[model samples]
Target: MTSRRDLLATLGTVSLAGFAGCSALPFGDGQDEKSDDVALPAATVEPISWPESPFPVAVPSTLAETHRDRARELLTAVPVDPAVPNSAVAEELQSDRERAADRLETDTQEPWPTQELSRWRDRRHAAATVRGTYRAATGEDDAEAVTERRRAVRDELSAFVSAHEYRASSPLEAVLVHAPIEELVSDCRRRTRPGSGYPADPVADPFQAGDAVGLVEFADATLADARGLRDAYLADRSNTSAQWVPLSDTSEQLQIALAHTRSTVQDFLEHDEPPFDADLDGTAGRWLFTEASRRVETMAEEHDVYRDDGDYARAILVAGRTLAAIEALRTTIDGINGDAYRDEVTVESVTRTAERAREALAAIDASESPELAAQLCRPALDTVELLPEVIEEGYADAGRVQGELAWAELYARAVPAATAFVSERLG
Candidate 1:
């Protein structure tokens, strides 16, 4: 009966400690200066060495010979596209970047003077002036206006800092820039059109525009790191001989899968269901609700396979969070007892199907046989496939069911095509 939080906490404690230990050893006393010197033979005193290049010298590769080509292939497979930018997510990320630029400018322009108290007082006064201006321009209860002003302030600060020729002196520079940017992006992408007919509350929607942006950023960074590693390994590939390759072909397979998953999720978010019932009440709500449930179930099933891989945890977390949000929406639909909302019964039934799919996912063990995992995943997939029918039947009104039916038709057509593509590639 351990909760997800409990499991995550345990995993964090164990995994982090294990990784920390692998990174370093206990420090010891400094070596004697005499021991560091090495005497050259008298015959080699003139010291004739290999010619140095005027350009940067290429370092020899460090990886074992067997892994060189595999590493190359992996590096080549890294996706280069910046994530497809959603305007809302872009705005959030830009705001974060501006904030960092402002902070950097302020710190550089008004560094501590000789007198601590004087410096502190000066900073306080400057901050107060800025605050007064902000408040005057954006009154209380107007969050959007406040946000825009904050962004403007940050942009101005960044420009000032850049003009001042201040260099990044500490690790905090990158931290300040990357952390907020990542967070804003994650938040913006979480829910698509928050108040859409989807049964889930806008607050609880799983897909954050921000998270999508962050994932793309993370993937790009990982690819860069991998490419550097590959280049270094390949530089010395000729001299080293090894029993087994250090880089596996599986890296390419995993990258392709990740790219596909990102694309699929993005597609879902941008997708617009055809106009259904004129009323945005029960019929429309039920259709959107069922679609949301099905999408969540599909994503959860796909993510379950990669739970064991450290890099895939973000995807797994996204899927789980989305599934939980859909579940909550279902609960909300069930609780709507008013006569006007009777059509929401479909939302309840589809939600049960989603829960069953989630249960199947929880039962799956990545460590188990691949065949078994695939078998388990099929039932979950089947459950998702049933959602369209549930919506179509429950909302028997032709106009109300149009959008839901179209999506279901698309899902049915696409799944087989996708399956065939995977089968052929893997076969």
Candidate 2:
């Protein structure tokens, strides 16, 4: 287990003499240091304040009540069962996932215009031939007219290709556009439209509107569910108790669940799979519920730290440093295998570290004693020091990491000074 003190001590050691040039000793030549002769600098430190709590103080207050009401509404709207194989929501969720997957595969398989330009060329040739036949039959061919007709054909083809390219380039945008089309098609096919049978204004019916409304409602409800889960996890401190698992032990599980949820939602919106009833109660719904619950719980716990009368600023600074160190390490790792290792660590790891850093920072109270400041600053410093090793490992194969040589040099220079600052302030 990595203790706070250990992390800090490592930081202090790395920063004091390794990175920062400043020494732990007093400045100037060695002389009889007279306390009376020495004049301390005036205090320039400003008061630091904590941020407002995201959750309300009163459990039964408007905020809580509203959330509760929303939760109840969601539960009523979409009944879920963890053990059951399929529910309405699960079916919907699965259908969405399949659709998304189909879209993704289609997008991937669809070659760039440049790769399929020959097809367009053939079409243009055919059009030109038709124009030629018309001109020959009429015996009224004008060079300018022929050029203009060809230009128009080319322009239209170019625009069509460009649109496909744009959609192919951006998965998110493609999904957004595809979602409405899927919804429209689904609504039209369904018999849930208002009126006993299709009549006047058949195109614009309650079912279509209801599908749109349902999509929006589902999005809002999902966010609310996530928030609720996060809050619950944070409030429950007992790690070993049933129904309240320790966050540390369950982080990986939660991450996987979240990823699955995100994937399911993406798939549903993209309409990759055939419409199925199991989607709503499937992986997407369960994952969303689980992940959201965990985040809310974690965030709630973090909120409490801000309320504590601690050195919040320093804590934040420490967290920033920790993140910086982690980034540096990542950079170092990237340098190791060159571009081959790029995106290897996964964005999720970085995001998780950042979240933890934010929580740790919130727990810090900058108004604490110098000793506490040292303790708080230590972890960040140590993490920073490890950057070089990470970089070195990254570059070990190539003998040197590229694009980060300057950063390595800078870290080497700054570590000592930073270390000295912590030591002087703390000791």
Candidate 3:
């Protein structure tokens, strides 16, 4: 198990780029622009091309039963509290396991994007780690002094988990633009602490206590990945016209986006799924999207802090998702009638387009109206993944963007209606 000190140290040092000399890049946008003082990245960036249409993963009853049977496999060794929420713990863990399994298969199968292969595998590994933590917390290793240690571990993890917001990439556009949703989903699910269910209060219920502990260790690892992607943008920022906004603005934008996301999810749950060109209206068709929307809403409420306190990494994560939510809602309702990509989508062209995006971001001065700046900044951060320096070999990274300029024009379009969405209800 990773200690609290170790986790903080790791988060502090993590960078998006691991290659040597990558950290020395300038923070400025290379022109006569004022510094926005954004920090490093924290969460991973989902691509903008993944399917926005929802697809459900049915967890067979037999499979769920199997996991439930083994949920208490580790509890027998330790002196567990009689009130341990075994069923709730099992359900949450199994939900994670099933989701990870489904994503692993989908990500690896033919035609689906493989650019995020490593992230899916890492989630699989994380699910296993949760199992391990569950076992360890139950005193599987040394039954002698388990109770005291479990409480201490849970307290530490609870504090860490509360500090970060974990929500799925809402709106299909956000899902497509951001990194893999499983990363956020898994993190959010772990924080559920299903054992206690409501309020998720940290309890001495050892069998039900591993969720927080496992998420803490997993967070440390994901932060490193977030750094790699974030640093990639930082390194490229000096070349593009993208300017930074105040961390407070970024936080405010995130808070607004999150609140909007919650309301959107509530709307989604209350009404029928928005009519898609495809036949995605039935229960099976809407299951995954509905569940994800619910989770996003729950998370928005759980970690509703409005101030970032100068943490740039947190700002980047929030900004990226908020932008995705904005764009996704547009796509879902407005509908992409035909190909949304441009005629030419080469690396150079995309880079030029991305620079235009940065220019747009730079142009939206927060001094004009912090709310508009906050709204537009989300789209600006969404462009980070489009930088030529960060392009990789995969459908999301190269295929769609290279083949069709997937999200190349998003930032450019975002500039006109940063504040109009409220009046127009466009999003």
Candidate 4:
């Protein structure tokens, strides 16, 4: 089982790279709506156009494969490295030809433009969706400009999804642009003050956006083949699935579920069956792309939930470390006082947890929001320093834990708070 300490010890240390570091260079972590989540490749990480090579086993595209050609063209114009264009910016893509060439490079650079560009593109796509919904609601052809723009946005969305698919991860983490109907059948309303940090006029509505985005039940299968291949590779490398993924509690459960999910996908793919059929009709194209985008968002959320779930589990495991320290401190203090009450006390257990806890605290990005850290994280750390003094003085008994009662109470609160904070962010 990977305990909290063990996980931290190995994070960001994996020799993760694509095809000898040249084919698909490490790029952006993922850029979606909220958070600086990485999306596709960013500057310093370029996608590699794989050289034609025969595989021992044929690699046949499946599921979204029918629309794969357009998706592949997303990076058509992306060169090995893009030259600084004449102007630092170009208002919009010059043409389809120019767009294909510069799309990938443009997304990977300029103060990290992927998220902004994606949001812009999604907003443009939304314009079409809104119009489509409006026309569906009330037959209106007077909006010819809307129809033309809608088609334009539909094409743009197809390109966006193609770029997104190009960046899909092994577990099939989808790079979603925005939520389903929220981004699609959204109201034609804007903020009175765009950046004033106030609520928008419409507020937040849910039912207004039902399964406005479809093709959802197909997610598991879509990600299955990709995930199965990854799992099979890992198992092959280690010669056993157990060794490749040796986690405990929920972590282990999720891993096992992944194996099952991928295997099911593999079975379906091998049988030449798509996990789910998307409505590919011209009328359904807009909805199909919207679902594609929606899946990306859904995948991003699921990935985050899975990751945070592990962190939460890890925190629970580490709380054991805290308890172990408390027990050790209690025993040592019992010996120190010689069966008599001591106002203050000291022990090695306090020091060990305190020192290690600092490392754990640091992992949570302590510098992020100094004020919040000041209130929540600082107190526990401050208590660490006081432990030795209290122990030496044999201060007020902290019951079974020993030393100061405040020390135990402080840590108990702080540790869980940190755990909750990690989960909140994940949600």
Query: What tens-digit string does per-residue lDDT give for candidate 4 at 105-219?
Result: 2322211122232223322232222322222222223233433433444444344334322121211111011111112212111111122221121112111211121111112
List candidate 4 stretches off by more than 4 Å: 1-211, 214-222, 225-238, 243-245, 249-427
Whole-model alpha-carbon lDDT for candidate 4? 0.27
For model 3, residues 1-427, the per-residue Cα lDDT tens digits are 1121222222232332221111211122232111122221222223332221111121123322222223233223223232224657555545544543443334222112222323333443445445544454333442322333334445544554354332212221122222233243334334433332211323334333344344443443333333333333334334322222333344455557656654653555455453345433221122223323332343343334313233332333434434443444344234323323323323454455445545544454422333333333442343343323233311122222221122323433444443343212212
Candidate 1 residue-wise lDDT, 244-283, digit = tens: 1111122234345545554543433443441223333334
lDDT agreement with native, every candidate: 0.29, 0.28, 0.34, 0.27
Task: Tell me the number of clashing residue pairs for each predicted model.
Answer: 12, 58, 17, 20
For each candidate, what TM-score against the reference? 0.21, 0.17, 0.31, 0.19
| Tens digit of per-residue lDDT, candidate 2, span 152-216 | 43343344323321121122222212222222223222322323221123122322322333333
lDDT of 1: 0.29
Best model per lDDT: 3
| Residue 22, candidate 2: C-alpha displacement in angstroms | 40
lDDT of 2 at 281: 22
Q: Name the weakest run of 10 consecutive residues (lDDT summed) in model 4.
A: 170-179
lDDT of 3 at 105: 36
| Between candidates 1 and 3, the lDDT winner | 3
Highest TM-score scorer = 3
